[model samples]
Target: MPLHPFHGRALARAIACAIASASLGAHAEDDPQRATTLREVRVSAASHDTSVDPDLPSVVETVSAARLDRLNVVNVEDALKYLPSFGIRKRFIGDENATFSVRGTSNQQSARGLVYLDGLLLSNLLGNNWANPPRWSMAFPENLARVDVIYGAYSALYPGNAIGATVLMTTRMPDRLEVTGEVQAFTQHVHDYGVDRDYGGSRQSATIGDRSGRFAFLIGVSHLRSNGQPLVYATQALSSATGGPRPVTGAIADTGANGLPRQVVGINAEGQEATDQDEAHARLTYDITPDVTAGLTVGYWSQDMSHRTETFLRDANGQPVYAGPVTIDGRRYTLPANYFAPSTRQSRNYLYGASLGTHRDTGWNVEGNVSYFDMDRNRDRVASSVSYNGAGLLTAGDGSRWRTLDLRASHTPDSIAPDTHTVSFGYHYDGYRLANASYNLDAWRRGGAGMLTAANGGSTQTQALYLQDAWQLVDGWRLTVGARYEQWRAFDGSRATATAGVRYAERKETHTSPKASLAWTVSDTVLLRLSAARAYRFPTVNELFQGSFNGIALVNNDPRLKPENDLSRELSAEWYRPNGVARFTVYRSDTRDTLFSQTDTTVFPNVTNVQNVGLVRTRGAEASYDARDVIWPGFDLTANAAYTQATTVRNRRNPASEGKQFYRIPRWRANLVATWRATGRMALTLAGRYSGRQYNTLDHSDIHPDTFGGASDFLTFDARVTWKASDHVDLGAGVDNLTDRRYYVYYPYPSRTYLVEAKFHL
Candidate 1:
């Protein structure tokens, strides 16, 4: 295949950056010229990238505890900030609405990925957008032992949500005794059109764990207080506004994402957030004999958040204008009542999990775990308008929860033929329910629920069974095959308005998917692998039942939606030495009945709803290189680049998007990190991240992505230094967005930020 000129240029730039990164090192290690075996590769790989499961066919990218401590990790999600071919949509330090992006998956598609913390499911799969981000707050950075990311749905042990990837987070339990404490502070300067100031935050955490005889216990807690930059802008299409004599100043003239005349009036209340969040976690583990163990984990998280807005427009008297019609350069623009309305929110959540497992080196191994997430108290209060802080609306989510259960068994028998085989099977179950309602409030700050205004809620459940076998066919040859059968059902769905409500009929579906992979060792330093899999992602509850009633008729949703069927393929080649490992991979995904919220243009009325598209296609290539002592001893480098071309293939309902790029998926991305160990106790590091321009719409009409509401291209640099003052204390400092370049991913990305931290260990 030949690359187009546009993509060719990007590839060239990536190669140039790679060269620049390699040139930073001065001394290269001379590895011994010896024949290596598969055992050597497995050991070396596991030492660096600890594996959650060694039998997984796909390459697992991981960040170990040692690596995590060396980096400037503000939150648990930061540990995955620089992984190969990965993107995280964490808008700020205390952002709860954060999601992950991988090959062929957009950042907003949360259902395409799955996250697990110590065998507990953290992904809120009720929806696939901002509100459904994984519950990273449940586990703090101080307690994370390791995090592993597996790309593509090539394993039978996981469900269809693993199509994009699967994240497995393991928190450590002390064997003897351990104590750790950390404090972090960061500040970032912002200079957007109307907002210009410095925002900062601070965090503190502590963890203590110890083991006595056959029992071990660990406990950790963290608290964060942060203020973030404005996320939503109050803008008007000047071309459509009327001219008036009442004049106003301070509005900035600009072009909208659609390349149209626009005027920025002020900021919205969505992202100008000041947040205080707290999390506490505890775990207990007991050994029942030598090969059997039981464990329990409990977690709690609380959040107090407030949103504030500011206006740029001012009248002749120099008084601020937050709402109503305002004239800017003789063009009159009307700001809606909610344009600058302030709001506040509070939430308390709990998680409980338990597990029992038996481990033996030669016979059958069994493992079972169960987890539940409870939304104890969740409420949000919003002012009615800019002038009215006394009365508004209150949205409460009281009975929302999710639970998961898994049971698995594996057998490793003696080799009976020319090849040896290891077989494993598992059963999985998950269910989710949400109950959200909005009511009128007499007082926005403190008031009782007056009257119910609207409600939308639903429930979804899934059960699955899978079996997989890993076989050593011959010398340097291996093959793995797996299959999964899943049954999904959506029930107890209801959507209501002020005057009417509707209950949807139950829906059920069953699907069986097949997975296979083949690996061959070409030489001592090289290995090649091919993988293919068919997976299905069922419709989420919110996608099927969350909608409004227009004159007693349902709108904006479709309960008759179908599941997405996906077929993915990948080819990977890896080369490893004692000092480093490198890989180059190409992958493709062809999905049928892809889900998207669009209008059905084939009909005369052009009804718009959450519907299924005919097909979508994506193809990409990725190259990752990690080396120590690249060109010089004591120097290390990690770099990766990816090119993805994702587009809508068949969408008769919305023909304009049939051949356009997928929303929110960038075309090119790259990351590079270089570290220099100045001494035995000090280290200095530099990192850079780049993401190509992307559109926020399906029709590719938003060519101007640099605006306030656009997904734009950005390249950022970061630096960090670490010094071990003693055997039990570590100090670190870092700065992100070193140049303070302004960019937007719908919400402005972080500007130049300074971070400092101190860690005490015992």
Candidate 2:
């Protein structure tokens, strides 16, 4: 069946608003909690909420469903954009996939962040980096209840991988039997110089579930489609030295024969693409006994995508040449072979998992989970190349398939004293396999008589043991200490690694990290916080085992690179009042063994290598304020600002390169959000975000070319409107990127767009 398309963010916002309206109404009859605004605690930072207090050693942020709705955040990447410390880059290579980096620690070529769904690891085991474009589409956006971002490394808690940050997502639970759905449409325009082009798409989702009497179930489906705009580029011959066309044969023939005549030809930019997604989830709870409870959850997801494009060939005179009929590998071919799509690619994925947990008053809590995932991609052409055999056309084809399994268990103690103490521990295991099996048409058409297919597969197994202790040392004073040990092994391949960390925190006005902090409650309305700790991040699969491909150039992974480590410290102060809240924090990180892509001149087209380059230092500060109670009932306003500076301290061949600013690391970023409740059942909100100019590449060179360098600055605005129609029903509408400004957060991002949505609940 053909896939469907829709604007993801618009759909999510509409659904969130409807759910929020229903939840609020259901609780209106009960007494509401006091409005003593406090930063929400995040489970991803640690295994439990004992670390929720701001006096802890880590920096954490939480995005609730209500906030997501207000911002029209549809995917995980979009949700993280709200955090000033996080950066995202979406490219045309992977439509549904985007890249995420936290602080300045991310590996631009391959993502450095770790992803978890309800505490289950989503990192690709066959490779080190998290999957490109993230597997976010695996779950319907409306299913997300909250997202937890834990900044800095928590090797002791998460082990081996905790580097720049860890993202954890928790889906919502049905409160009662319910049915909900949403539909949205959007249009976009991209104008280069005076030429103008238009593109647009639509999306829809329907959900049915029952949440009552300890039993809940939810099933949903979502789809999106778009007619993409064409791409333009300056084409050149393969070589200027060789004047005549070289023999077009062998594996490298598609790149144009060594001396092939080349000329600039306008490429067609017309094509259509679509995606279809479906999901099913269920949760069961039983009060095994008065003090004990058991819960089970199961979920499944699937997605399918398809796209098509056109191809062409130019002659020496820079004009179209009727190459009649060319034949290769016993197949006949034509210039505009209906099969060639210049910018065509397609992929599909299926995921499912289940988990069980038990809670008891005996001061003991235990949970176990297991999951499976499979993904596949098919391409009509290997890349932008074309081939011909004696018979006709032999389009190059490629396919990738992945399968994974994961298991985890955790246990926490039940009770203690006023100085409440708890020790928690857990274990995790993962397995993965990837296969590249497709016909190499180019290889055969060049003279090779046999079919060619490149096939390689590998697996990885990792184990971690960690323990943490939380102690309320004294009134207004808290202490946390923890450590973890991790080991990883690759089968059919060769490599093993291990690592560890410790942290401490104190509540005081003047605090020092990596040392001590002293917080004094000078008054009922004032308090101080101080903290310090050491953090680190290990290398991922892509950095160590990935092979090179042709795009920017050839590249290879170096398995010899070591893990990156850091020693960090931070200080902060906060003030709380009946009507408002304010906070400020300053932090610095001393990082060593940073990884980067290095060139190898020894090989033709020099292959790129991943290496531990040098030392880096980063310092930053952030301030925020929010007012609600003092501004009149039903009204709230919040503003936040941050500044960061990062420099390379040392490197291999160029010690002078030290002090160079890190690439893609913005110096200033900020945001503001305001909301007004016109009535008890109606509300409106506005939000604005800004990012300072940042260099894209690491070399910091404008003349010398490198993949990572460029500069960009952007501003975006969004608005939302909501209405409570009745006790059980609500409606909402929203607009994102309201200005429809054509810009790029990174190169090749989609241009300005508009979206509208409608949601219903029963």
Candidate 3:
């Protein structure tokens, strides 16, 4: 908690800005259009701006409300699935608990991807742990106005754990009283398999505000539920060591010979058992002025799992056995019992902030803002089981609590002709605290083993200051330069340490990010742009100083680890025509000192160290085509495809995986979405996703085997039909996973399902 350094950095940035302004007068003025229009506009693009311009160098994609409704995307993950650069792997279908990796950075368990709701940070400030990773459950898709995806390193602007990409979710703000609702149900059948699964959910939302357009407020709530099935293939595999049939459960216990407890084996289908999920969210927004707005949100999620296999005890034979007695964390339980395992997660996030921006009459414009973010998450996992002695037992009751406070502010200068420029400086203060406690049943069962309870908690605070400037040197070319300096300190009462990253980006573009190409407006219908940039990522608290607690022994955190930095450059061109649009981009990211988990053979079960393993180089290409008002009136078609190759360029000492492929990062991914509006009140849509094979683990060991980890591909289809019953009422029906292709994605995704719903507005 030192204030001197932060103040000094701020002062230095102010002085630098003054110096730049003074020097601007002497330099040969570049194209005045470059300085006045492109430079200032590009700076706004670097941070947050809706308008798509070519001068910005970062890749950004926006999902529209109309698109959301057509796809019936209920969660944040679904909303952005069409983007070629982003991928999501969920443990269950119809569940918001998912692992998201964009541009291959989020593939690692320790990877950090920042999430924001209306500019409020949702990434946990606690030590980096998947338990507290930014979750999709915080906001429902039904309440979103739009989702903006900013790809690559953005820490220089947002300042936190933003390394791979930033997902900005903006809630719907209404200008008039409006209400909408939908209910859906569907069944999925695995191809070549007789098993068919069914699931469904419903949502209702309302927005009440005035049409005056100056002062307005919007409040909405959404609820969803589903009975999800397991995605892993349940078929058994023969073990090479014992020649015994191995069940494909991932990390769960396995049966041994004669049912006697043996070594745990591999199982594919052993993921979250049949489970029911419930989620609810509420958002309130108020527009204080035409240039400023504020909002608050609250969300709750609960999961109830039935028949979840806690442990696999073996019988006398090598065959798998379900009925038996077992002990977990020193608690004994009987089989064939409910085994009820329930977990509840809830979050309350508040944002009371405003944006003040203006275009001066003198042609000098300025934009600045200050905001406060308070976010908290509570998670509890409880297990209740029956004992062989016919006694009721609650073996494990564990819970964790996390809270974060964030404050940020930024400023942009006025645009000057031919040399127009914007210098932005900001400071961010982030405070995070976490507490976890786990209980032991053996202590209470044995009548006083001291009532075993292990607890740990810590706090961290960080202050960051950054300065960025966009200078227009010519009409078609611009330069963007910025650097961020951060100082982070963790307090365990007395012990503390600090870390920082200084990053910069320089590029020229005709449009913002992907829209940046080489094509120029030779005519009214032809335009082109091309550009590239360098981005970096910093390590999170969990990856640096996290302590281990989970039963899995291979995963461990290294306190001495350094930050992972990368140089990412992309080049692309696009053609915009009256009938359709086609764009393609080729990108490469050379990462040095990439932080990754390295297994420690020094231990029996093997521990791991989160280290700057070596260098990783990734190259990829993406193409997309969109045709609006296609052959049929009111019909639209969009198709996107991406191919990526990621490999370890250095790992001289670790031969075990020196050149192995990264985990969970597919080399190829593609999607297609089409929609047709037959009438003002009716629409039909179809969508599909495909991902190439990927490795599950770095070592490729059967114990952590690459079996459930290999390449998997599946095709799913969905369609929705809506009808306006009256001015105040509307009805709709939809089917998800229309083909019901039984497939595994990261885990088991839900099979095909159908739903029907109706809504009434006043």
Model 2 Cα shift for residue 269 (angstroms): 11
lDDT of 2 by residue, 1-762 (tens): 111222323333433343333223232221122233222121222222221223234556666676666555444466776574666664431245455765666436343566666544554434433244456655566777777776665324554345567777776657677788777666667563223667766677778777656555666766655444443322233332432331221111122112243332233322334445454545454545543334454445444444433323444344433333433222333344323433333454545565555544345656665666665433333323333333221222122323323322333334333466554556655555444333334332333222433323344445555555555455555455665555554444322111211111211111111223334444555555555555444444445555533443323656556766667666666665454446667878777887666554335665557767578888887665554532456665556667778787877534445677776676666666777878988878887666655654455543211111124455667777777777665566666556654443323345555556667777
Q: Pick the candidate with the highest TM-score.
A: 1
Global fold similarity of model 1 (TM-score): 0.94
TM-scores for all candidates: the values are 0.94, 0.74, 0.73
lDDT of 3 by residue, 445-526 (tens): 2221223233344455556666655555555444556666666655541111122111112111111111122223333433
Ranking by TM-score: 1, 2, 3
Model 3: residues with Cα > 4 Å off, grouped in runs: 1-55, 109-111, 125-130, 186-213, 231-377, 382-417, 441-452, 493-536, 549-555, 578-580, 601-605, 700-711
Distance (Å) between predicted and true CA of 25, model 3?
50
CA lDDT scores, all candidates in order: 0.83, 0.50, 0.50
Query: Which lDDT tens digits does candidate 1 get at residues 1-762?
Result: 111123434653765567556645424654442222342123223221222556677867767686776777888889888887788898888998889888778887899999998789999898877788888899878787778888988999999999899988887778779999999999998887867799989999999999999899999999999998888887888755568756889988889888897888788769498899999999998889888888899999999999888888888999988777777886667778778889999999999999988766546888899999999888999999874458899999887999999999888665423388878899999999989899998888888998999998999999999999988888778888999999999999998878999898999999999999998888887888889999999999888988777788777898899998999999988886666667888999998888777778778777877788888899998888777777777777888888889889998888899888788888888888888888999999999877777888888888787778788777777899999999999999999888777778888877888999999989
